[model samples]
Target: MIILYDISCTRHNTAWSPSTWKTRYVLNYKGLSYRTEWVEFADIEALSIKHGFAPSGKRADGSPRYTLPAIYDESTGAKIADSSLIADYLEATYLDTPSLYPHNTRALQAAYEAAVLAHLDAIHQFTAPYLMTKKYFTPKTEEYYRKFREPAFGGKRLEDLLPFGAERVKQWERLKNDIGKIAAWYDKNDRKGSFLLGETPSWADFVAASFLVWLRVIWGEESEEWKDLETWHNGRWKKLFAAVKKYEAMA
Candidate 1:
C-alpha cells in the first residue's frame, strides 16, 4: 500500500495543498488505497522529522520550504516531494485503471490536459501572495497562530507579520479583485458545466477546482460577507464540491 500525507493547516498553501486534494481524487479515481496525514503547526515539526521531510536546503537558513502535499510510498520506499509530480507519478505507476492523464499523447486532448496542468501551476504561483493572509499563518510568539505588528498602523515592524497590516491587507484585497478576474475567466471558459472537461471529471476538473475551494474559503462560501463569490461558487463550483464530499464519504 502507498502512503499519502495530505498536509493541511500548514498556514501556507504552497505545498501541493490543492494537489493533495487532486492526488486524493485520483487515488479514488484509480481505486487505489492510501491513508491521509493531516497537520497543523504544533505537530508539523514532529511529522517532518519522523518522515525525514525536515527542511534541508533553504529551510536550514531560517527560511522554510513552506510546501506541503507530500506523498510517501512505503511500498517502494520512495517519497514524492511536489504535488504535480505526485499526479504524474501515480498515473504512470497505475496503468490498469481509467487514465488520469490520457495515455494518448498524440492527441490534442492530452496536450490540452498538460497545458491545463501548467496553467494551473502558473496561476497558483502568480497569485499565491494574494491568495492567503496572516490568518492562515501561525503566531510568531508561540509555535502556531502568532501575531506580528498591528494592521498597517505600524511601519517599523518588518520582522513581524502584520495580520491586519496595510501591505498584507492590501495584497489580500488585491487577491479578491484578482479572483474576480479569474472568476470572469471561469465564466467565460467553464460556462459549460461543473467539470472543466465537460461530462466526465478530468484532472483539471479535480485539481484546478481544489484551489477554487480554497479561494472560496478565504472569500466565504455562499455567505453574504462575500455575496459575489458565494453566488458564483454556489452556482458553478457546486459539482466539484459535491465530488469531493462524495469521495470523502466513501471511507
Candidate 2:
C-alpha cells in the first residue's frame, strides 16, 4: 500500500491543506489503495529528512524547504515529494487507473494550475487569520504556522493582517471579482460542463477544486463568505464543487 504524507491539524474530520488536497483528489479519483500519515507543521522537515524524501523547494535564504503531500510507494520503493510530481508518479505507475493528464494536455494543465494560484493569491490573507484559532490548529502547530507566515506579513499579527471592517469588505469584494475572472475561463470550455474540459474530469479540475475546498474548510460551509461564494459567477464554483465531491474520500 502507498503511504501519503499529509499535514496534521486539529480538524481530523477532514483534510484541509489545499496542496495536499490536490494529491488526495488524484489518489481517490484513481481509486488507488493508500493510507495517510499526518505530520505536524514543525515536524515536516525532520520527518521528511529522516525518510529520505527530497525537499520540495527552497526557502528565500536558499535552504532546502520540505513540505507535505509527499508519498512513499512501498510497491515501487519511490519516495516522491510535491503534489504535481506525486500526480505524475501515480499516473505513470498506475496504468490501469484514470489518467489525470488526459488528451496529452500536461502543459496546458500545468499552465492552468499556475493561473489558478496567481488569481487566488489574496486567499492567503483572507484565510490566514483562521489558522490561529483552536478550531483549526493546536497551540504548537499555530505557533509554527505563525513563525512560518509572519515574516511575509512584515511581522504583523495574523489577526491584524486583514482586520474586520472596511478593509475586510474591500478585500472580500476583490476576492469575489478575482473568482469571477476564473469563472470567465470556465465559460470558454466550448460546451457546458462542470469541469474545465467539458464533461471530462482532469488535473485542471482538481487544481481548481482544491482551492474551493480550502475556502470551504477555512471559512466554514455556513459562513457568510462561503454563502457569498456559493452564488458567485452564476453558481459556477458551487457546481464545480459538487462535480468533484465523489473524489473527496480521505482513503
Candidate 3:
C-alpha cells in the first residue's frame, strides 16, 4: 500500500487546513509505511501537471488548481483531492486497524464538520494575521494570498486573500472566539472516550488532533487559553502520541 501525501514546505505550510494534519495522523495511526514529498506554492501546479491531477481551478504556473493537498497513489493509479476526500480514502484503504466511519455515519460526519472544521477556522484566526503580510505559497508570485485562496468567503479568505481588511480582522476575532465553543462541546460530548468515536479513533479525531498539534506549537506552553482548550483536544493527542510511540518501537 503506497500513499503519496501532498504536503507543504515549512515556508508555505499553513497552521489551518486540518486536512494536512489529518493525513499525517491517519498515516501514523494505521502504522502505514509511506514517503512524504513536500511541494512549494510555485511548484505545486507543475507537480500536479506532471502527475495529471488538479484539485483547484488555477495553478501556481497560471493554469488551474490553485488548490493544495492533492494525493496520488502510485500503486493504484488513483489520486485523491481535498482534505475530507483524503480522509475517506485513508479509511477505506486501511480497513484492518480502524475505520473512520465506524457507526452513525450521519452524526459522525456532522461532528466532523462541526468540530474538526471549527478547528480549521480557529487555525485561520490564529494564523491569518501573520499570513496577511507574508506570502504562503510562492514568494516570487505577485499575489501574496495566492489566486486560489482569494475572493474572500463572505469577506473571509477562502475566495482569495483580500488584503486581510477590517472585515477579515473581525472575522478572525470571531474565529478566535470559537475555540471556547469547541472546548465547551468537548467537555460535554467527549465523556470518557479515548478518541472522538467513543473508543476507536475516527477521521473526526484525526483532523481534530492536528488542530491541537498546531495550537500547542503555535501558542507555546504558557497559553492558558490553550491549556483550557485541551479539555477537548488532549485526549486525541494522548491517543496518537501513544500510537506513534508504539509504531516507533515496532521499528
Highest TM-score, which number?
A: 2
Rank list by lDDT: 2, 3, 1
Model 1 collision count: 12
Q: For residues 1-251, what per-residue lDDT tens digits would candidate 3 score against the true structure?
A: 54444545345333334456666666666776666666655566677777766565544456555444666767666787666676677677767866666775746576557755644544554544434444444454325444545544344553243325787577645655565455445456545665555657666655555666655545544676455544434443445444433322111
Q: After superposition on all CA atoms, what RMSD does each candidate show versus the true structure?
A: 6.9, 1.2, 5.8
Q: Which ten residues in a row have the lowest lDDT in candidate 1?
A: 144-153
Which parts of model 2 have CA positions greater than 4 angstroms off? none
- Local distance difference test, per candidate? 0.53, 0.88, 0.55
TM-score of model 3 relative to the true fold?
Answer: 0.66
> What TM-score goes with each of the models?
0.59, 0.96, 0.66
Worst ten in a row by lDDT for model 3: 242-251
Residues 29-74 of candidate 1 have per-residue lDDT tens digits of: 7777787666653455467667876342344345655345667777
Return the candidate ranking by TM-score, descending: 2, 3, 1
**How many clashing residue pairs appear in each of the predictions shown?**
12, 0, 14
Where model 3 places Cα greater than 4 Å from the true spot, the runs are 1-3, 10-17, 56-66, 104-107, 114-123, 131-138, 141-176, 217-251
Q: What does candidate 2's lDDT look like per residue over 1-251, in tens digits?
A: 99999888887756788999999999999999999998888889999999999999887778999998899999999999999999999999999999998899999999988888889767777787787753577788778877877877889888777656888888888888887878999988788789999888999999888888888988899998899899999899999999999999887
How displaced is residue 90 in candidate 3, in Å?
2.7
**Could you tell me the TM-score of candidate 1?**
0.59
